[model samples]
Target chain A: MSKEFIKGNEAIAEAAVRAGCRFFAGYPITPQNDIPEYLSKRLFEVGGNFIQGESEVASVNMVFGVAATGIRSMTSSSGPGLALKAEGISNLAGARVPSVVVNVARGGPAIGTILTAQQDYLSATKAPAPGGFKCFVLAPATVQEAADLVYEAFDIADKYRTPVYVLADGMTGNMMEVVELPPMRELSELPSKDDWRVNKLEQDGNFRSISSYSPTAEGLQEMNEASEAMYQQWDKEEQRWEAFMMDDAEYVVTGYGSSGRIAKSAVKELRAQGIKAGLIRPITLVPFPKDAFDQIDYGRIKEIFVAEMSIPAQYADDVRWATKSKLEIISVLTSGGVILETEAIVDAVKERV
Target chain B: MEKSLLIAGFGGQGIMLIGKMLGFAASKAGMNATFYPSYGAEQRGGTANCTVIIGDDEIGSPVSRRLDTLIAMNEPSFVRFVDRMKKGGVVIVNSSLVQSKVEDKDVKAFYIPANDLAQELGSVQVANIIVLGAYIAATGILDAEFAKQVIAEQLGRKPEMLELNMQAFDKGMAAVK
Candidate 1:
């Protein structure tokens, strides 16, 4: 129960280390450099390994190599860097390697800007890889939550035998807040890698190889079906979201990550002004808490506002897909690495209500 | 209750540090605080700013369009952010660099010769601390004694500069009264 003030990137890195991540590899990028920088010093202290890779492609491959040994490994990058790691991410997903990939996202299309932006939602949720494979995406609104989510991402990745993404924007990556870090986990507590890891081949005297390739068509179909099943299970068990002041909300504002935090503030202020505005924040962006959308009282809620720091409103599409009602889905957006202001959200809600 | 403050100045003015120190002290006092700096290329020598929010409960948004208070260390900062303060909010300015007067009638403005006071105290590098001390003195957002303690802890490695910083803080605090 000890609290300390720390930046989100540094907090996530510390949480990963405490969660028994023994190896880290990442290329330097704005807003996420602190993760590799902090781990370069911390992992060594914990008898772990760290590598400053030559490029994002090389760094993610390093993580893939580390994860193949059946140990917790991680890599981090921003939007442009994430684009570079796409091939490696696909390899991790295809090989069913349980590794953590952190994206402290900035504006994009192509190296847009280094400031805060939620532009990577589509890239992270829809297509993180070349194939149709998926990654578990966790979006944290605050630094404390970012640390907690990063700590939990390892277990989720291990359980499903897939890659997990801690999707944070530059604001969450760079902001400082008081966080109560989770206790350090013992190495012995980690799940045994005896069954699958390539290192165990020597002890078991069995031929085991980890690769993304499936030689036969039937084998590829089986792999895809297994991945689909894992995604289904995650949708059933790992869907996380928050509903604020929605009991009698007339207008429900929805967002995720940094945008959600700002939208919540606007909803609170709108309530103070006698307007019945509420918020639904999706914590897990991949299996996105669609149930939260279903629980909304459509009889009371007349409209839904999707607030995001992206002009195209990438997250709003998911909201639209989950929502069944014919209620208007309005988008309140700000792009180009600019943060969505509370006043703009409040004004948007006012206009609709 | 929740309070939000914006500290703005040139990149080398330690604007981010001031925001971090305030956030640290607020969190130490058992309040939830968040500090977000304006990042990117502007951090070299151009204008830099940060937003700090302190609340009794969990903070929702770290950035706000209208702030409770603003600390401006230069003319560009004052001109850029003065209109963003809420009505009746306090604006603390560095008189040595910012010559413009606060024009908003509803707002309360206090100008401190922070650079001059820090120079008189033997170092202009501590001008941000002087402005911070003045901010605490004028708004009473946090206890002056607690701020001094945080300052000492932050600068523990540089014991020689600690005394000078304290002197500058005291001088700035006195200037506000």
Candidate 2:
């Protein structure tokens, strides 16, 4: 496959189309607007449906509706918009709808800025909604990874019968890079949903009922237990991370998405400066890659740096939990649309190393 | 080897296109490249800029804090980004719009009247291509032929414009030489 220089949002959108996604419903938002903007025309050209929903909430619900028919579907938004779509996302999880929801995250506690940030770490991985269910989160640090992960997300979602979240940031969404796109999935090769899809009643005569509600407490308990079981399976099998220059690393840096990407350069600079610094970039954020921390030589390592674009450091909590707070953890942070500089990260590591 | 450059100017000066062309050319030449634009409210009559990084290694960050090259299309762009450049960096200033001069002794500076060159070519819009041509000739990081190929593909829809752009590219290369 020939690589082409394309923006992350466009790559993701194209990947989704290649992955057999026949439907997309989304509202406009900065940073991530390109995803839907690309899809608006791209999807239609593939004979797929593209709807610019009245609102983010409506868009997500529309995705939920499309997914119920056993069609691979998606919706995308930034921070504020993601918040609006939370209820629909929770509904998708509850109904076990295999769909992809992309959160091209931007700065915010609430409508903070249109610039990039990693503030949605907790919201995406921890509490996507009021439900006890979790969306399998894939955080991509590069445009190539963004396309690859989004291409994989549809399959991951179908396999588990759950919503998969591609947690990208504004930087990744806006930046253009050379990427080798995945080959298009044959529609015939796509998994059959005849037995489960509601719209297939004429063919299967199953008369399937898909709803987030189970009616009775006992039924709900059974549903929750089933969800719990699936989650356990995901946690056991899906934790993915990248260990960069960790062969003899005495200083470890942990981050995901854009933060992780920036930290990688920082790791290189630190290594150049005679510091054995390494980075653990989590490719999967929900199943949190906690075991990557185990690779650290705790006996010789100096410290751990938790870098993120969020102030008060939401991602650091996972790093702390993963390492069990055994070593001193330093946080390298920037907030409210400010980008994390590789030089600053190197400087921060220099202080400790 | 890795090279990072920034192209800055006011909106509508084709600032973003310059970065995209460089990135696409690098990619076509089988190298890794990242093009990150300063998007959003800044595009509304404000200064528009984009950073392009080309390297053999996997490019990590989309942006570089210390740029190896700076292509400033106007005075403000030169003023804003020159200091962020690494020492001994290559700077291509559009002398037609920029009154300020590069004072850094370590920096390899090229003062090109890109607008004037574009006027000679009959369109000021091709001024960016002129700068891009100078960048190629100055850096030699990428083959000039690859850039011409990318421009042909990018401007393929406008056949009449393609001939002018090709001449503009040649004019730019000659100016640097």
List each candidate's DockQ score.
0.86, 0.84
Give the best candidate by lDDT. 2
**Residues B1-177 of candidate 2: C-alpha lDDT, one tens digit per residue:** 888899999898999998999999999899999999987678556799999999999998878889899999998899999988788799999999999988889899998999999999899999999998999998889999999999999987789899999888888889995
Model 1 Cα shift for residue A304 (angstroms) = 0.4
Backbone clash total for model 2 is 0
lDDT of each: 0.91, 0.91
Over A1-353, each residue of candidate 2 has an lDDT whose tens digit, in order, gives 79999999999999999999999999999889899999999999999999999998889999998899999999999999999999999999999999999999999989899999999999999998897789999999999999999999999999989999999999999999999999999999988987688886655454768998988999999999999999888779999999999988888888899999999999988888898898899999988898888777888885788889999799998888888888788999999989999988899988875
Q: Give the runs in model 2 whose Cα sits over 4 Å from its true position.
A: A202-206, B43-45
Which pairs of residues collide in candidate 2? none
